[model samples]
Target: MTRVIVAAGGGGDAVAAVMVGAALYGAGEPAVILTYAWDRLLVDPVPGPRGPGDFTGLRPLTPHVLAVPAAAEPVAPAGSTLPRLAAELPHTFALIDPHHGARGIARQVGELVDQLAPESVDLLDVGGDILARGDEPTLKSPLGDALTLAACCRVDAPVRLLVAGPGLDGEIPADVLRDRLGAPVATLAPEHVEALGAVLDWHPSEATAMLAATARGVRGLCEVRGAGLAVPLTDEGPTVHEAGLEEALERNELARAVLDTTGLAEAERHSREICGFSEIDGERRRAARLGARAPAGLDPDAALARLDRFQADARARGITHTTFRRIAEVLGLNGTLRLDLRDLLLARRPEQYEAPLWRVPAEV
Candidate 1:
């Protein structure tokens, strides 16, 4: 049976989805993953959601397509680790454009469904935030998860919502998720945790700590910088909960409204309207406006020089966190500029780079 597993929150969720998909479908089973290129600004510097424009060599199944990399070719724009799974796993990775929003993404999902004819579609959320009601004070990045959830609900195929590593994202607590969705259908095995840890080694993600903790059988409160909160992970470890999509929607009024959203913009607007802030996306835009520009494709020396200057300026202004996207835009660097910026900064001043994707001024 053809199965499509989508990373509901993008970034590490995509990576985690691969492991979960493998566990459910059996190793070597050909499963397709639908994930977005948008990672935490710490992981990717670019602001806003990425589109097909950010990728290379994606075989277009339709005008709006879900693409896997051509062989080992890079699928995402140079910096993102979303498609890095292409090298590790035998499964196909299909990217859904964040720019298209929910309506457009739903269209893409429909197209893929027609072409692949997958018997099951699983929307995999790394954290339990997918169950949030938008009023969760700790919710940082809710738009993407909500949009993907809405899109999956829109699809004709029966979509199962799988939440793994509850409270890991620092949004909704694990207890809240279990209370809402009932007991988990499955818990991650050592093999699954090993696979996730292997992928984390290649691409260091904010989600790594939670997975690592889960794997080691650590429980209780955990601190994830991305979440900005010390959330609780149950002692049970990385368990996977299965809930009917309708049951999930009924639990969260915000999600129900999201289901009615016409597009991504609408979904985002709804979030901002309710929460009174755009969270990380807002921060990215604010930071990018003050971005420093260097040349696109700068050599190592030039890139380091730019980073030095940027850090100096940030220190002068007492700016604690500056993302790669802002740096890339300011530098006027094109194509993998974030990757270049990240590499140079990390190599030259590893101390300046902090958790969750930031080039911090040394002082503060």
Candidate 2:
């Protein structure tokens, strides 16, 4: 029988869940992965989370919850990697609609359990941001994870919250999470990273990329996001920390604030009131500025020259590594060009590049 693994965050968490599932259960175990189709603002310009109406050809699992088939595609102006993931990865990907808030999510989970009858359920978060106190300066997105936490509390099955690659999301620092985590349950090996295969070639999740890199013995300070948070990577980067769902909820103030919320706005309002931050507001503002335009093409020589300068500056700043997203931003390329930039940079300096991140070569 299949196990239920909830992708606590979004795309990256979904990928991490596959790794966790394979480690916990044997490889190729059939699983029903409940996930949100919320791609980053760069990928999907749409301001908040997309509901059932946002996509076409979703297989209805229930009145509220929907299943995204491999053929499913997001409606116009809305883009998602879930369908592509459904096709590439070996798991049934179900869509989580947080439009109706936590209660609705609880109802959806209950319905799913009744239908699928999975052996066990796991709530996976790539980073420990799911345990954010709502006041951390680095906290970016907690609404979705909070919604999952609150809703899982109401689900009939026992849900275990597994945090893989803690603080890799660049939100919570690894040192801060050290005290919060208990004994490590598992460590991702190169084989696990290899299992992900070609998805690493184009997927834009920096944290997940770091996880794979860590498994492959990568270590250094990774500068990520527009904020340029310097995340320290160590050998512990691949270790998975298992924490109680109750304890995690206890640590997260935002999750408690949105437990009774019925609408997405209600939850967002709670977030603003409790955490003093609105992720949707940030997304809306960025969407207005960035629009949906694709990244502009650049001359090969000029691009490499610019990258050479960017690398020198980063090295001077003690930044040993960075993600494609950061490189795209540095080159003034829109988010759409992240993969193209990766391919270009890799083709030029294959030895200095990892799958989804680049390592700055020592001054030579």
Candidate 3:
């Protein structure tokens, strides 16, 4: 099922939203819909009509699905522009705003939940400092109250409470969030700050790249262990030492191809040294003696069958298994190779087979 992620904040929350969205997308999830509550802005048409009109002018950002709400007057005169903007952007996933008062914001969220019931929603409270330290008394603090109400709202999906920056202070504790809201409360990692900044700055590409880099970092940690393969220097030609079996196989292939080629001034000499064969004068002599002998006038199908037998014999003798496993491990396919090998071995002699050695944990 597609989950809806609601991000609430000002310019600062934008980057975090984008980064999260990009990360989710990279993980093969649906694109995140970004919504911002215009909590403190006066729009042009109205003195303070708090709804979704304040952000309508930003319609050009349809590709990113950014929504802005209109302004709420008198009580939230500065933010009236926000609601208006939000009203215009229907494509956004969810609307979020810090509560000036607990009950009112809770009631609003409850109403929104009822309206958007069955659709999963995650609420991210962005720009908390503004609500906590704002000037007006009417702009009291509604974050704590709103969170409480949102937690109690009846829905199949639990409400996600995301607090950004210093705003994390007043929200429910991690334990309480799990127990009461039936949701996990997580802090934005410090590393995500730059990604958040990129989103707010409207640099989607940069934000996406940063998220990708983070994924790669996490994947590297999960895959690599110890001081991995090391390079070496040698007088012969700086040959790579401690190279994995895969590298050795690649080098062997190159050497084989060079020895098999026809025209070369020093072909006979190099071939003798490289292939460990007796001396030969010309290309014809070498082809007749050292080169792989073709089945005399054999059909194409027969030739292919002979080649397959040779390849299978090479594998069955374990000449390629070690290198294959090492390469598979490097490419994150060790588990798959183990499974296939176990299946093959078991099919041959079920009574003698045992469980696979490379058993990745179920959780992983």
- lDDT winner: 2
Distance from true location, Cα of 259 in model 2, Å: 0.6
Q: For residues 104-206, what per-residue lDDT tens digits would candidate 2 score against the true structure?
A: 8888888888887879888889878987788998788888999999999878888888889988988888788888888899998787776676888888788
Q: For this target, which candidate reaches the highest TM-score against the unseen true structure?
A: 2
Worst 10 residues of 1 by lDDT: 220-229
lDDT of each: 0.66, 0.84, 0.30
Q: List, residue by residue over 1-364, the lDDT tens digit for candidate 1.
A: 7788888877677777766775777666677788877654544566666666666666766667756663534333335665567766666777787565677778878887888898788898877788887787777777788788878888887788888877776677666777766577777666765655456533544454465456556544433343123445455547777866776666555566667656566666777777666655585774575355443566778766766676576556545544454556556554455566667767777875443245445553
Q: Give one digit per residue, the lDDT tens place, for model 3 in 64-178.
A: 1223423322242233323332333232433333222223333444555554452445444432322221222222223222222232232234554443322122222223222
lDDT of 2: 0.84
On the 0 to 100 scale, the lDDT of residue 190 in model 2 is 80
Candidate 2 differs from the real structure by a C-alpha RMSD in angstroms, to one decimal, of 1.6
* Clash pairs, model 1 backbone: 42-357, 45-325, 292-330, 292-331, 293-330, 293-331, 294-331, 296-333
